[model samples]
Target: MSKVYILMGVSGVGKTTLGMMLAEELSVPFYDADNFHSASNKEKMQNGIPLTDLDREGWLGKMSSLIPEWQSSNGGVLACSALKEKYRNQLAGGIDKDLEWIFLFEDFSIIADRISKRKLHFFNPDLLKSQYDTLEPPDYGIHIKVENSPEESLKEILQKLNMPEFGIIGLGVMGKSLALNMAGKNFLVSVYNRREGELEENIAQNFVDKYSDKYQLQGFDDLKNFVFSLKSPKKILLMIKAGDPIDEIIEELIPFLKTGDLILDGGNSHFKDTERRLEKLSELGIHFLGVGISGGEDGALNGPSIMPGGSKEGYNRVKDLLGSIAAKDRLERPCCNYIGPGSSGHYVKMVHNGIEYGEMQLIAEFYYFMRYFQDRSPEAISKVFTEWNLKQISFLLEITADILLKKENNQYLLDKVLDIAGQKGTGGWTTVAALEVGVSLDTITASVFARNISAFKKHKNQVRELYKLKNKADLEITDDELFKSYRSASVINHSIGFELLRIASVEYGWNLNFSEIARIWTNGCIIRSSFMEKLSGIYDSTKSSHLLLYPDIAEKLNEDQEIFTRIIPAILSQGCPMQVCSSALNYFLSFTRENTPANLIQAQRDYFGAHTYERIDKPRGEYFHSNWKPE
Candidate 1:
């Protein structure tokens, strides 16, 4: 059904002017009820005779008929002197449509002065008193004083119609920061979190108390009331845990949501789960958007890279708001966009975490090399890391330097922390995806395995005591050479990651933009770096299948390959584990090689299991079985 916006008031109150302006602004047809008045009624009003209720009957009937006609198309805006309750009832009661009444009210003296200045209008200035006496102000419709400009009035109308632009359905750290971020952008945000006890209640209350004075924020503990607080075509974002918890919350929210509402899941959810939810919610005319929000607590509070995917219509509705709250690049473009259909956003975020794992492992290996091989103390290592950061700027490197500099009770804090690292499945997901796509993500896979090995505390200790294993400390390398080797390995690790993304984009049909991904990761993400900006430039200039194959990157690798070659074996000889660095070197070498020994393995398979093998002299895909054992 179409909508009807009726600008109603006493004559000379600027109804026609405001209605025309509103119609143009809203892109709707404008209609003036006076144009539909009968000749006799116009004559009476022209001769200073007040229009009786009977005189308006024909005009009102014509308006009633014209309303539905305009509504049948794209809706309309009408300047109607619906000064009486009965007239408004007749205009609204005769149509099955959305009717929004806007009363432009002003003091009688102000309107009378404007009426006195009218030159060609039919209605006389003396009739203003009769119109006011007959007026019955509407209690339900929006009322705006005639004291504001047209633009201000239009803004107020849109705001009243779309208040509480976003409804956040969780109050955890991510949710709270997102709510405050929206509020900071001048968006009215309604926040809700399930309160099982006093702790959750206190958290909600504290957030409200802290930011309510500075922003337009409201906190709700009741789910039904929270849903009620939002405007029509509601946008509700859930920042709770993934999986079953998301399902439970959706089930609870479904009762309160109407058709055309949108529910966005902002957790690190599995893509398959997002696909299922999108399918299920769409049946009820509700849209589901799977959003991937990166950057930890600080990024949440400031600005984070937002990846939103799912329904295109849903994205259109929320794009401006998302952009308003997202981090901006050096050129100030928002780091948010509609990624693709279904769970593509989450898939990108998963790969992002996998690359994060590889980068973190590479830094750890460098730290270990400096500490054991070069016999550097924590402070010494921190100074070197800080110096390296000036030339190679990255979020991980900056934080690593900070961690190395931290001290507690006269001891290095990082040295006292446990060696075992905990993971939350994204790295493993990346590995699984690599296997599925037939791509090699060796560096990241090694990083995941290294974390697993670190968990074998008791077994490792027993083996160490049995063998009297010790790390050699005599090996040394200049800081410049070590930095070059680390940089080379980091490039190779990223090369494998981008390759996985390239293959997955083809397999998933997402048409993922590698340059856009790099641009977004330049800031407000865990893997943010000056290197990402350079990577974006590389992808923009050349569409290479692999980063290592790109001309600029390949040239850099050629210059640094010798340093990587020298460091890998030297670190191994010192008994210091360098799984990620070693894997990166091996991957680079294997990728660049023109030939490999896998041909012998193919022949072995053919001989032992009768598996087929292709001959070097024959065309591809024509297979033959070897009979070496029989011979």
Candidate 2:
């Protein structure tokens, strides 16, 4: 974005000379406030008389009014001796937000020596001391020492004027934490949050107030000031809520921005919406990136898995700073990467959440089996999960173990919590995307349904009173057996999610790198686990669209398949709903089977609606319709 730059200093500080040079280099118009001075004021300075603030009021007002007019027509450079605080404020009053000031100064002797050589100027050399006494140097604007070469001084001015390298809009938990993360990496950061909500009265100002002394961070409440604070081709990350709010913010922010500025949507936005926004912004010469951020608040503060997708050049511009703030893999590579073109970053993140839903549901089922069917206490279940975590380390399992151990008033906190689970729509998005891509995501889909079923609390209570449910205390399954079942379900869950990505990658021309996605997930995501670390290596070595088709993974599945065969029926016999596990087993069985009852369904379709079925005895592409009754 463009801005009006003001060059301010004492008379002999070379403001006019440097301002002219900078205007030429920037290809903008230049103005000298000295030429706008009143004839009476100049005459007093010429006769060694100092002008009072009263004498300068009209002069400052006229110069201030010219700022907005100059800024409206491509930005302009103005040289002025705005020696007093009030005078500087007056000059900024016309266009308060988009003005950047550069202050040039030097030793008194050097300035005096330079002033002595001037002959044609109207101002008398005797008045130079009065100008110095009237000066009130600002602490905020870019300050450059003019004792250096003019070229060096100009270079310093330009460098210092590019105040902030990164800008973050919204200062919510995730946004606030992420801004700190970027600032921790030594990147100059500009943070903005609208002062509308009750809690947002001074959010950005408060953030800068708390941390500015420790880091190079500036905060702004005004959108225009925030937008203008960033350097050219601004890189901004929007960490606000997704949906219409994001679009509204973009609309409000666009007027202050210019072409080539990049905006990244870092919320859990629907990929279709991301695709639409990307196309719209591209037409306006503004680059839009759909970035998927995971690992929650703590991860955002420390290091999270960052998935960014958009224009290649746009990614390149912010990749370094993002990489510096992202979590590192075992080999010390950042978890952040350019995911793919279009909305693939959000797409991958949606699938990631789908797999998370499945894994969480399966873990919850494990807890239910132990607490209800096996009559184990919450403390005992915590121990079971802790032991299981040692065997198959995962973020979900680790947290589950921790959650079960939490107590309030000497009672297990898990007992007091409601059973109904909440979803944030990404899992549903994954299910919908799976259907659109023709991928059977039964494991993840079952998880989404399980949450929906939990939400029908009233109906469930009515059914509970109507029918007596069986308690399977007599049914004993060893921890080893339960872990095996859980692991088996999780494997299928991940496989289905990856298969969706594989198909969608082809459908959308994303050409996604499965290994890189897995690699990034190894450390900083909710699903991070030793299994993902292994899967990363598996994808690096094997070339397969389906994770189950990899020889190593298939061998592991073969070893684990026997436990599912026994446990699935046993668990279902107790009236326990093992949706994720049973769905996974059914999916596995169908995928492995050479033939299925789908042929009968196809025949039924053909008999009823003329949706023809292929003939097994004929070539693969040959199809035939059937007439059931007439034939």
Index of the highest-lDDT prediction: 2
Residue runs of model 1 more than 4 Å from their true location after superposition: 1-162, 541-544
Q: Per-residue CA lDDT of candidate 1, range 174-283, in tens?
A: 99888888888878899888887776775655778888679888778888888877766789999998889999999999998877789999999887789899999999
- The residue-by-residue lDDT of candidate 2 on 164-283, one tens digit each, is 978999998999999999889877899999878786787898999999778889899999999878876688999999999899999998887767789999999999999999999999
- TM-score for each candidate, following the candidate numbering: 0.77, 0.77
Best by TM-score: 1
Off by over 4 Å in 2: 1-162, 197-199, 541-543
